[model samples]
Target: MSSYLDGGGGCRKRRRGGERIFKFKSFGENGCPVEFDGSFRNNVKALVEYGNLEMNLCNDGVLCWTFQLEVHRHPPLNVLLFVVEEPVRASSINLHCKHCRYVGWGNHMICNKKYHFLLPSKDTVASCFNCDETNSYESNPEKGKLNLVELKGHIMHGVFHSNGFGHLLCVNGMEMGSDQLAGYQITEFWDRLCTGLQARKVSLCDTSRKRGMELRLLYGVAYGHPWFGRWGYKFGRGCYGVNKPIYQKAIEAIQGIPLCLLNHHLSISNNEVSVIFSRYQALSDHSIVTLGDLLHFMLKLRSRLPEENITSSCNPTTVETNCRWSPKRVEAATRVIVEALKNREFRWVSRQEVRDAARAYIGDTGLLDFVLKSLGNHIVGNYLVRRCLNPVTKVLEYCLEDISTVFPNSEALIMNNSKAKPRNKITKVQLMKDIGYLYKHILNDQKPTMSTGVLSAIPMATRIILDTKFLLKEYTEEQLPIRGNSFKLFCTVTLRNNEGIDEGSKKPMLPYECVSFNENTTFDELRQEVEKCFREVYWRLRSFVVEAVANMSVKGSDLVVGSVEMGQKLVFIGSNDDQIGSEDSSGTGIVDCLCGAKEDDGERLISCDICEVWQHTSHALANADADALLNNIEKWVVIMMNLQRFYLGILHIFTCPVVRNNVKVL
Candidate 1:
């Protein structure tokens, strides 16, 4: 589909009125005689087919000559030198047009040697070019002369200057790229070995600090590599874009310091590092700042200043120091940490500062000591860290809060009362808010709805948490109800007035009654109501039979309810046909099948007494009754299936298409 300009500046000859005027252009160099292959028509046909364009070939059985000019020599096709790919099939054409030959302006010029021409795979040779046979050919096509300027604009934009791109897209604001930064310096190499830490820019008065970036940037940093400093620039230039080998090598170089060296005789265990991570679970739970960031910062901090007033104890009781960012914030957070530890609420602790302190005090091994200081114990810190690190659980918790807080703020979908209220009082604006609230709530609930509850259930207040902002909005707006701890906002109920259908004709009947319910009601309750509604119909039909056919033997007087199927349900009665053994003279007899039975004679009935008695042997739909329904089934099973399907709001079974005759069936 994508065609490149080729051959004689990609000149396309146009035909007028479905006819082409035969015209030929000539190329050669410096007084050399060139031969024509005498198959120009065939070659022209091949060219047309190859280019997927339709054109007619002209052959009046006369040799016509065009202007002769000097141009670069075209290369010969070497079949043995070519390696073909079955799928791509892009065979190399060795167009060795290094120099052109010019010959006299006679009708035909003769060369002393034979020249092999390189041609694209088309059977005909009509449009083929002839070459002088003087020179020996090699396989490589680079030997040919090329006009590089023609491809310059195609490869890169005219204004593309590497230095002009000021910033690279980041998780937050566009960060200054290496090209834009002084000396294009990449300060540190962060690899998989380093811990990932999260840092947030101080927010303005109007915006919240916890707002997430619209897009995430997945980056790997490695220390001490030549390319490390130019990562931003190289990435911007798209240099190692999707080439796996180049990208991997660059990534490896970025991880400058080998991970093995960092792990050498490290006193603190990973478990200790994990504890330090857990202390600030709420903040890190959403986007965890890796320990690597803190470790790197600590290393830089240590290098910046000589160790002074440093305690000699490996695990000192306590140390007071500035936080990672500011001394004032650190002091405030330290007090909170101490209080959190005293209260045994480990979730409130800040692990980043503690980790930095631990690394400084005991060479990263004292991380355990720091966590224990905040957590009060190693076991508790580990447990707390695990809980905070679970992103899935955290996301679910956030969604629940988001939904509950906004639920009361949602506008009502007024079905019954909306019409009664004046148009001005309809709260049209609230409708949009309600729709937004419902959309978010449903989207958030979709995950839990699809999942089995047992897997994600937690003892903590993991469910139904509300966002304070949304809660306040709901309170001020008077949009939703204060329903229990979870706000109960009223939603307009949809009233479905289902029509009945004809029995014999099986046509849909008109609207009989309306059904309405709260939007918040569970699906199971809805299913139960539908089952009950269908069961009423089933029972009514059974009663009709009991009254109409008194001659037949009857089972239990009471009706037994069965499982709720799609649209209909099955009911059973007491008494197996075999148990009664024979029909009693005083006992009842079956007059006719109440279920549209056919007559064998005018007076005599065709209904079997055994079948009538045994039809509903299961008096109760208990587990034991399953066996009775399984035995001695009736032809009406299909009808029951259809009825059940109709009741369940899904009745596609009756419309199943079957093949018949020789024609296809719908």
Candidate 2:
């Protein structure tokens, strides 16, 4: 909300408290705007998005105004323009803007092992602090000096010049028109760019190489375009201090007229809240306003917010406005208002809605009570809703979650006074070290806790990538026996070379190598033959799973134990060579089949695939499609679909033990 304030002197009357106030403040100027890249500012969108352009207008002539947030590379600086038509008869009035671009920069941490920082002697210069130290990022270069690489320009060391600011206040008699109409954002262009006078004297500590800056200079001139450079000042008169305000005012107007708020990519805080309040107060003094006006007002006064939190404003000197106001109450009210603003109840209509709701209440006292209660009960837990992520914090959270979920406080939930669940079991601070191990063994990253790359020679170092830094801290040869159902990880290590330089290269030689069970089967124990098909390492080791089936085929079948009718399994007893003739020999070969041996031809046999059993004709007909044949499904089942099933030779049967303890569903 800053404007480039050039000297534009005049008189304007603004209505405040129904009294006319004439403004002739010398701290004023012509509207020489300092244009910044205002393309994608979204500060105003924080409020709420309107469904359509029609939603922004109201019968009270309340129109939405725009203000661009200061952000880098946000495009289309003047994407939207908003102007409230002023009365044709109103006197000509102009308001000046003073743009204030801040100076100074913050030191950044080096990306590599060497400590890096910006040169305080010259803000743009970059340098490293640990170039020659033992831990500095490097490799063997020459015999004498450590390998030092010089980084040039600001970006080499990384830069963080915080968002620069702009200021807007009355420059002329614009109070001539009602503040409501004039408050609508008007985009206008200005001219002129300036540069710094000259470089200042620099004192470098050649020995230490780096020192933090004590006081940061607040230069009004924009970067590269310092207005003082064009002023033609002499070293004799201290011209920089004298002409800073004048040059700053002139440079403020050098930007294209900004129309509306583009997009605000920066986070919002109480500072933005304060700015909004100030603007609302300024405009509302002249006329009634809407929620959109309040939004712009917040952006205007956001700069005035105190730099530090007023934790306990016990000191009066630190207070602003000559300490006339209590900082605590002001801050509290400001916070509460911001909290309410997060809720979208104050949209659509304006002051009229508030008045209507108040009048609709049972009484004025009742409305006041409700307001007080609502304010008191508000939680105000998360003041600023942000979606930013911090990697360090996220890693910490993961560690905490692993500990909490798997290792609870042993007090499992109770049920009917009987123990129902397991207890807390993971040992605290059990580390899996990698520092010394990795320094010497750089090629492989497979750890005892992981079973991921057991077959592959290449080590992906899954444990390192998974943010277990807390557990991978200290180096130790001692092993801690792990006990817990919370996490099931097991591994064992063996090396082919256990002597000389190759001893440390002892990797887990077996794919099924684990803490509890190590699979190292000898060749003799395996049968005379092995499966001819190709298989992966894990599957090859588990080949014993099919050994029983293979043996059954070569030797004899194993015993079959199942739940079945007494006579169902041993249906034929001593009878054999069963294949009964079809009842209708020509209709279909299956229609006349019956069960019995060839010698017991006409003994009323029941037809079937596995067995042809001799039974009475009535029994053979009535027992078809019966449960006595299915035998509890889990062990074995004869799916008899109908009484004619045997006639159709549909003696389909299947068997398997579904209740095995080791069966895994997925």
Candidate 3:
């Protein structure tokens, strides 16, 4: 007989040399031994010493034992009972296999007395007996090979030693009816094993006292299984394993596991899961939930409950409002803006284009502005009101300065191969040509009327004058021209006969002349010079009227010849003696309206009493109901002036519909 210590440090004896085996119904007619095999005997002894196993002596002197058994067919049979005819042994009994030199006593090649004489069948054997084949049981004809679905149902099993080191036994799926395996059975089994291990210390300790000890590290062998990696298990030296000191892999596993399955297994409510997930999200700065600190938090939660759910659906509003700005996302957005500008031909980009580049990461306009403002040193404008002239329109518009300019300024130089060259001084002849081209278009009615569009076109003609540097002229009291300071004005002169008939039968004689003048020339002096050119003409000259075109309309204002802008058009109307004194020489009676209508047309006129400017009544009023308002024009002007709607130009008059219907109007 061999003696060993039981769980309470009491000595126990094991019976030996029993050739006459006593059979019990539980062990079958071919009685099985109650001794453990060499490989697994130490694990059984540890469990017994920790009080995980219960032993009692029966009235008949038979020893009965109760414990949990985790097997391949049914996991965690929590109340397996066995009767021992003698004292339970603590030491392992080793047996040898001649074929493979394997020295395990139970289930390796054959079941021996160590396994209570249980027969070595396909379901119970670990290796083949005669051939020493390790995979013989898996290849057995009676046990069909597992399909992909059945293979996915594998479960995990492990034991944590007192030294804080854990050993994984196996993760294998059992053969079962199709109905028994459904809906993430593998994860379910893993949760159960983890739960059992977490409670192992508590369940083994005496109930009268409480212990706070827990497993620290869990290491497992995956046996070349690829799915082990999918569960956050890493590999080392051709074996897969997991280490949970900080539970980094545990958090990874929780992230991959479905929330619904976790909730089901962990018995966590949806609201509780949401709270935990929200807390994690609030603490994480970036859009993604992969921070190390957050992962540590989730691992701590999982450690507390073992099966605690760590992932759940988050509230979108809460996530948007509470999440801190991420430096990585800001960096990404900045990179996008820079790249967009770098790909462009100009050093400036519109605000809309900048917004579009970073829209994916920074959706809020104000937040995007804040980001742009933070890059103020790199960009050109204040966040809200940066302005740049549009290349196409030449109009000032909101824009962002290209970050490429601030970073190196080399990218802009490389991209803009056709950068604008400095404008040279425009010659007098070139300025004349540009003005003439504009006049030609205006005379042909091909250009739009003088509105904002025509005003925009003025820059095209004036750009030549703006680019030129003219030398100032020194004028004498006699007004003799300074040679270098003089420019030629090209004009077309039309001469009419005394009776207002053309000199030619087909058309009036339009003579072209080039008049030269200096900066000191007055309007009267220039007129006299032009009169000298036609001194010998048969028709007597009338008053010489010089009119300047202003605001796209010919105005009768007195012309100061030397003060004329470079591109301004001038008209000289010379009538015969019969036409003299018939019309005002200054042409003061002329009127121009905002609608481009002039005075003395057939349409009735309505004039603003205050400014005395005339507008055609048809152009000013949509209906005749405004006749009363027109009669009281002074009162209407006062009301419009008080409302700040009175403009000095053409009058746009209208009586409200309420007044037309005879309703009292405010």
Candidate 4:
């Protein structure tokens, strides 16, 4: 567990001399384990400048943002979960956490448990927390501390305990070392006297004796070396016996394993695949419904495997039977699978792929039983589908609500990123339900329910915004997806000035709306939606979300959006007489803070003699460096006095001859 030392940041309450104190708290192993290091001002600046803005596009309009700061040592390791009221406001945000999760790389095999189980420190201080009086009766004075081994009865020696761990194991004939006998006697005698600290109901040896392959499943804590390989050799020394590859490989994988299909023991006999399919067909009588139902039932049984690290390019090893599966070849196969899925050529989930993942995660006994049960208690099907989903959008979904405006930045609790194996906890039915829930929120303007991922939300939002008009009609959850016939998606995809804006003859489009539609109404449609978001949303807003205060009267408009730029424009959309939409600015539509706005004085309201448009003097002077805006010298005299007045923050309109001649304010 990491512990944060002395740290500070640019606190809201800065000291008299402009000194900012940034304080952070790290939780220890008991609940708090953290450490943070960074420049205070630099940290605040990054968050304020580049944070992702998030908002709930519901009637109960909410707004918020997330800020991430990279640790100096590891760029991917982020330190703060800074959630804020608004993206640009640093002082009004909440600091969610002060520590970051470790990124366990360079290890031969990175598993999920790496994040949770930290190695015990050599300097571990053991004390009796359960006892009121921890002091010993003896005045030895060194009585407060107890050794970890003393507090916990004993460490369970695995199948083969060599070196430092040898004393904890008992052997049949080899003379028991004095130290080994001493430990065995103490453990057997103290089992009743020990507390609940390091107690396990049963030991691994009990299971290992009945099933020796149990050691193969301990790759997580194992150094991945076959320290127990010699123990298996005790059963035989000849090539006809345990010296064969079958006996040696499991132990070798626990030690010197290669990265290949054979190493994973995943290849199936060509006849095996046929046998499985034929058996399954016999069981189901070729009925698609029975097959589908069985598959569905079996898929739900899949569970997460912590030890597997699958990438986008991973595939089943069945194809590698004749040839070797090098990492490169495996990657190529993975790409082919992805492309096939993208093109909708065929729907497939590799049985071998699922099996290998289960093997990596489960004990040999459980793996065998799971495989058998998946095959319907017979040797029918061997596919594992439980933890099949991955966090593809790859980030947690966020929402903004009204409170004291507390923004808690919660980085993912899991340290593993996209490289980790996909989750098996969710099923297709559950995923579709989540998507449908969000879909209803998008079209009906109803409140959104919490979802599993931001990836799902992004495309749902993109589709909702892009297909607004088609969705104008009220829809039942069942009535959704207006399939087959193409409906216009008012897409906001920008075309360069040189490119054609109109889509020739494909679909008619309203000029103001940004939308698009597709024939696909299933989950795959989400992938397209994510693509659209990357192009339209991620680039435009950096990330896709905003602040929405619960119970706080959401202002600026009748409708709320997740965009700052769009929100600003929409706020002025229907305001016929709002101060910012006064008739004086007439054709200007809405004020462009970046450009400037005009007043209706009809005179001395700074006018560009060249372009003859109303302009701010400060803006004109600021752009004098550019040859275009303030081209000639004497032309400046026409608006010189008005420019200074405008610079002084006065909004008095001298006049706009374009719309009116009267000095309205005067």
The weakest ten consecutive residues by lDDT in model 1 span 466-475
Q: Encode model 2's per-residue lDDT on 242-296: one tens digit a residue.
A: 1222222222221110111101111121133222222233222222122223323
TM-score of each: 0.15, 0.14, 0.18, 0.15
lDDT of 1 by residue, 199-247 (tens): 0001011111111210001122212211222222122111101122323
Q: How well is each residue in 215-265 modelled by candidate 3, as lDDT tens digits? A: 111111111112233333332110011112212322222222222222232
Best by TM-score: 3
Error of 1 at 55 (Å): 68
Ranking by TM-score: 3, 4, 1, 2
For model 4 the TM-score comes to: 0.15
Q: How many backbone clashes does candidate 2 have?
A: 47
Alpha carbon lDDT of each predicted model: 0.21, 0.20, 0.29, 0.23
What's model 2's TM-score?
0.14
- Candidate 2 vs candidate 3, TM-score winner: 3
RMSD of 4: 35.8
Q: Model 3, clash count?
A: 2
Q: How many residue pairs clash in each candidate?
A: 52, 47, 2, 46
Best by lDDT: 3
